[model samples]
Target: MAKVSFDGTSGFEVPRHVAIIMDGNGRWAAARGLPRGEGHRRGVEALRRTVRAAGEIGIGILTIFAFSSENWSRPQSEIRDLLGLLRLFIRKDLSELNRNNVRVRVIGDRETLSDDVRGLLEEAEELTRNNSGMTLVVAFNYGARQEIARAAQRIAEAVVSRGLSPADISADKLSEFMDAPDLPDPDLIIRTSGEQRLSNFLLWQSAYSELVFMPTFWPDFDRTTLEQAISEYARRERRFGGLAAAGT
Candidate 1:
């Protein structure tokens, strides 16, 4: 992969892909004595800011955890509100994203979504498929366990149908069956709201990702916060179970 130059910074390694677990919307809203819906609304604004910031910082790909499969277990009213916000974001922001040359890619279980929502997700991807700028991957209705299970099922079917031999299955081969197989694994995974757990997001892709847990809530995250996270990532040495480089 070609290294992205952060302008005038000599020998600084930046993460090519960054994934975020946006959390604590409800807590933020509760602290302010406002409804959770308000927190989600503000969270959307934070996302907009972060997207532009990621592009400005030369991040090649930004993947955000928008909705998890377990999120469906939440209250129906809250789910409705969350879905409404998603609709609003796409309908109102798609044009701007396209104009800015940002490509939108959605990964998840699409067959389980409502028809209209599924169409909108596809539209977002199709409209920006040719964009050359930073790619924004939205993980909606996604769960890593479910994704892996689906991949396994596909591999099994291929073997049973004589499309693939069982002996040929390998980790790399199985990865091709995953959602958004073209996307590179995230180099850094940041979880806001001081969360210390993965919470079933990007289990496979985050195998070697540097994890950062920020105390700021999702609604409070901004460009500076993102930069700080990146700086933290840069300070650490990733060994991938091997010895670190000579210098610190």
Candidate 2:
């Protein structure tokens, strides 16, 4: 595909919900003869650009796959570095998020995170909770299978507790226990570094998402890549198991 410049004239409508799997940081660093941590350090610039682009483009909900549960299997030092980077990112980016009217939200088992990092996460979320702007969801230490399992547990507990019955469980009801129940399913999912698989990201929510895979590494992905992905999404036919034209 060729690069295109969308000066607001393109037939591109901002997706109501978009999710990203930021990949290839370590590979990018290795290719550049730099340490993996240095790659992650540069990747934050891409995160900033993508979030700001989401806001600029009017995307209502944006979810980023920051750290997965499997990521903990990496070398302990690397994991520590990632956590340190996250803490620093939260502290430095909160003000920028406030300036842009973006609200930060985290989806995952946050209890496992360090106390200091958790505090910063909570404070950032609280400060921007009321902002009527784009919602930025960071999935740290997250796994979709675990999320669904947790949702199922919640439903079972409710059924056993008092008024709910096992037969009352439904898809919508099951989704209530998800990390953020208010946000809609992702309309588009972009995976950088040319990955085609989901890697268990938003298994239930992304059932109907249009996927865009880019060869550019996460650290190299820029505003142009964002536009390209959006344009590709615009070209997709999201049937959702129905007539394509019938879809809004």
Candidate 3:
């Protein structure tokens, strides 16, 4: 689809939270006759550009699926490269993000992360903790199933400690146990590379999210593609399991 511009339009509304499944770096590199590592490096660059574009367009919350828990099973060298890229992003872009009032957060388990990566994550989160601007949430070593399991554990603990009954547990209350309980659920999820499956990104939060899947690869995804996705999102009549305008 061709890119669409905001063009000072009044009817278009920006979603409160936008989550993305960034995929197809390897395939993109293969098609271009480039190394896989090169593809990842370029993907990181695209991520930076996308972040800037989102901030420029007033995106409130951008949750990017960076490294999943399943990613750890990849070649150790590739994982090392990804970690190096992450550390580089923090060290190099922390100042830029702070200047733009972009708060950075990693919503994944840190126990498996190397000490250096863990330290960098803490530093980035703490540094941007005071920022009130757009929240950039990165899912590294994150699994939707694991998150739900952890939430279940917390809910059980609450039931025991606060004298709450199991029958009283609700979906809304269960959400409080997940990471970033205060953050609003994702309103839209854009998956590049035309993938239709969620791939364990955000199981609980995307119940009503409008998904925009495009054929473009993750590294090829830029501001223009983002605008197109936003336009499609605006045009869709999201009824949240109900009827749309024609039905009404």
Candidate 4:
């Protein structure tokens, strides 16, 4: 991916990759005296809108935190509802996404998922595998710590099986074992509902990502909200731990 830095003279440039932590669905529902499921449904709609807007704005990749491994701790009924929504979203939106030339990629531990859920995810990826447009990454049943641990285990296994030297392991080598090594690290990460933390999303990949937090809930997110966040991103200087340029 090409670097998108602030030129300081030309118009602002769009990020090559943007990741979002869709937060506050339950809180949004609670504020309106509705069930949490309703907020999730609306959040799905917001997701659709965001994907379209990202493509229109020339973003190369967009990653969404759809579900986390820790989400299983929620009420059983709520868990079922979330799963149902995932099924519904794929069934209804998969065809449209494919027609729009969107390539879908799912990352997480899938061994423990039900057969049906796993099938749907695979179908989405297969159907859009040849797409050359924007890539949409869904982090379902994901935990950053778990991902790193899994990579470490794989590296250890390689050393035992292939005689790979333990001393050969480096940060770059470990990254090659991550779920999606081809995708670039996120240039910007946005969280809605005023949240200020990463919440274990993309820990290894977001080392230099500019974060934008908004008070608007997930269900209320739209293209305007995304544009606002990108506008904020354009004003900042990214040194990446180096000294700033000679002049502002």
lDDT of 3: 0.89
Each candidate's lDDT (Cα)?
A: 0.92, 0.87, 0.89, 0.92
What are the runs in model 3 whose C-alpha is more than 4 Å off?
A: 1-11, 245-247
lDDT of each residue in 45-149, candidate 2, tens digit only: 899888887777778888999999899999999998899889889889899898888888989888788898778788989999898888899898899999998
Over all chains combined, what TM-score does candidate 1 have?
Answer: 0.95
Give me candidate 4's TM-score against the actual structure.
0.95
lDDT for residue 68 in candidate 2, whole number 0-100: 97
Report how far off residue 123 is in candidate 1 (Å): 0.7
lDDT at 81 for candidate 4? 94
User: Per-residue lDDT of 1-248 in model 4, one digit per residue for the tens?
Assistant: 43333334445689899999999999999999999999999999999999999888789999999999999999999999999999999999999999999999999999889999999999999999999999999999999999998899999999999898989999999998898998999999999999799999999999999999999999999998998898898888898988789644
Task: Give per-model TM-scores.
Answer: 0.95, 0.94, 0.94, 0.95
At residue 135, give the lDDT of candidate 3. 94
| Per-residue lDDT over 99-123 for candidate 1, one digit per residue giving the tens place of the 0 to 100 score | 9999999998999999999999999
Q: After superposition, how far is residue 16 of candidate 2 from its true place, in Å?
A: 1.1
Higher-scoring candidate on TM-score, 1 or 2: 1
- Candidate 1 residues lying further than 4 Å off, grouped into runs, are 1-11
